[model samples]
Target: MFDVVVCKKKQEAENIYSFELTLPEQGYLPKFQAGAHIDVEVRPGLIRQYSLCNPAGKTDRYLIAVLNDPASRGGSVGMIEQVLEGQTIRISKPRNLFPLDENTGFTLLLAGGVGITPIIAMAEQLQQLGRDFELHYCGRSRTSMAFIDRLRHSPFAAKVILHCDDGDAKQKLNLDTVFGATPEDSHLYICGPAGFMDYVLGQATDSGWPEARLHREYFSAPDVASADTAGDEEAESFTLRLARSGKELKVAADQSVANVLLDNGIEIPISCEQGICGTCLTSVLEGIPDHRDYFMTAKEHALNNQFTPCCSRSKSSVLVIDL
Candidate 1:
């Protein structure tokens, strides 16, 4: 974790806050492509991933935004509500898991609430490169949206569609019509709340859009949102073995495998801690992981038994994790 001072702050919405951090300019700040996010060290041993909303041009510092979710785990609440203006926080170098495809002809961008962060970054990049793309941003209300002014002022501003449920009677995001009418070569990107994301993805899949063409990002482990999903309703028992430590940990019916690993002092690089970012991805030598993350490429999980440790569980009794 690197120390970065909060250079500036702004309130984008009622609880949506933006922060610009000042990092040392001497060394190279990791060069991140569009759609990258950085993990900020809030307090000792606590890190949260915020998407880089700034466009690429200068290599000065990183700009991030955080929305205070009242129902969220304390991490986001602390970052947004409790963090002082000038204080510094440890930050991980930028990582790009949601990179734009180089050959994208025309892209469809969908964002719900704060999920607009990275999608806005992609719009900035697309504007610079003169790419053909359309962005659909859905929010609870106009007053609740972040970065709306910046987006409206962009050169490619006409390409953006902002949907506010409170103001518009036709408030819902019509993902099916959006995907159905889009060009065959179009690639789709989505980010947002779990219900919004699931609806968009499920509709897209049900509409017959190719899986490769649809992409999405999550801020937490999928199971957290999908706890009521099929199979998750019933807790199952499993055992995990740490290869390096030669210790076996039992997963209780009530606890996730991640909590068990953490209780044992295993250093798994986790950002979302909910299996959203693939940072805590662990190698699966055995057992079928109940893959519950948006991180995996269909081929990557099936071709090799890879799983995100943050939200996955084992179907087999003995699951060995390579930390």
Candidate 2:
């Protein structure tokens, strides 16, 4: 667990707060490139990952912004209600899964609502490095979007297009021009809500853009009543033997495999039990894991035989869990 002091807080929108936290006068802090996020322990057992939006200029501080999602089942609501100025918090070192690769070709970035957090950092980095990129930020209106002030002054400000949905007279941007018959050197990046991401991805696919040229990240996990997931999900039940406990647990089709293992007193590291994180990753010795999470590639799931049980189930009847 790493410690951070809340150095500053600013309200970016009605319910959104941008927080700047700094390390102690300790010799040096872990340096993080753009598109990195830190897992903050907001409560006794709950930890949430928030992206670092500030540039690498501040060696002493890390920046994060939080939106109070009244509909959020977890941290957002609590972080909005509970946190105060000058509070101390524990955070994990930064981890980057969404990173900017070296390229001279024009880059297209799409951000939907609060998903702009990480992409904002990438844009700032690109601007400093004098890279060619364009960002499309979509929101209901300017009132709900964060960082309007900073984004306006970005070196790539002219390239930043704002698409406001609340009767902006005209749509500020369109994805068809960005993806349809795009150049071979063009690379696209997106981060947004599920519906928005799905639509953009579908359009890109229809445009015949190579899957390798398109990249996206979902802000929320897919376990929340998704139509893509099956209702009559599991066909058969199975037994999972924990390597740590040397005990077997029965899992029913109605229950998640992770729950049964946890009920049997075997602890598997988990965050975002919704299957967004790879924290619960475990090796499967004998059975096929019905892969569900977005973190693992198809090849990784097949070749590595590792599973994320929080949302994954066993396809085989009897499997040995490495725990």
Candidate 3:
């Protein structure tokens, strides 16, 4: 289900714009956690998920920031250019796979570029609860950083660190210094571009940060050049058995399950067909799956009971799926 709302634009920084959304009829919206995101319907068939940046547990109005990217697939373009203030749009309910765990000894919030949206919200919540936390916000330039003014004036400004590459090189974010001295019971959260995420996560791992202590959410899928090459190999025909329907369908390696299903008159709800979103996730009744999605954690992969058909394939010759 979707809720129709009227949005008013609030400029945050440079090309970054925050929209305060309220129901067209004006009433309390659904309550959401710090890391929750809502899927906004930008156009007839185009939808994009954006993190709710407002304080956690706040139901007054949902706030989302969007950076005007010319390279976007019409979602950001539509929101920044087409959807003006006072215009109405539809958005999905909040969904959160990334959330804050308050039981940690300390919290490290690392954000790159527009990734600050969710991390900022997490910082605000942590501050309100009087928790031990620090936020490191990085951008190419000070002018490019969003919410800079707001954070500077906030009561928690002392807990915030700003790093800009255009500034002094020594002042830039030093992953080694940050991760090297991390407490054993601390939890780290990161969000950013593929390269930025890789660098932070790779160094954190080298610093002995356990898998359980590290959490990340990607606005885009990690750069998988090798995976793309492997996925494009010559077609290897396989069978897809629908456990519920007792039907079997042939799936060519060159064709994704979603495409094959669509051709066979079987429709499945899907978004971010690149496997970044979990909208097309389906249960695996039998057989092993080649997990190609970034939506699931390592623990979920170990269960082997679900897979995203939009991009993931079968490891076995046949995959029995619960359709």
lDDT of each: 0.80, 0.76, 0.85
Q: What digit string (tens of lDDT, one per residue) describes model 3 on residues 13-48?
A: 788888998887857888888898998988888888
> Where is the poorest 10-residue window by lDDT in model 1?
221-230
Error of 2 at 175 (Å): 1.6
Best by TM-score: 3
Superposing all C-alpha atoms, what RMSD in Å does each candidate have to the true structure? 2.6, 2.7, 1.9
Rank the models by lDDT, top first.
3, 1, 2
Which digits, one per residue and each the tens of the lDDT, describe model 2 over residues 1-323? 77787778788876788888877555455788877788888877888878888885555788888888766867877666676668888888888777776474777888888878888888888888888888889888889889988999877789888888885556655776656544667777888777787788788778776777777666576535545345436346788877766778888878887778777776777777766657788888777777777666545767647888888777677777786
Q: How do all models score by TM-score?
A: 0.90, 0.88, 0.93
Of the candidates shown, which would achieve the greatest lDDT relative to the real structure? 3
| lDDT (Cα, tens digit) per residue for candidate 1, span 1-323 | 78887878889897899998877444446677778998887777777889998886545777888988877777778887667778878888788888898578999999989999999988888878888999999998899999988988999889988888887556666766677779988898988887788788888878777889988887754434455324455768888887767788999877777778778776666767666788888887767777766677666767557787767777778888775
Report how far residue 317 has shifted in candidate 3, in Å: 1.6
Query: What value does the lDDT take at residue 13 in candidate 2?
Result: 76
Candidate rank order under TM-score: 3, 1, 2
Clashes of 3: 0
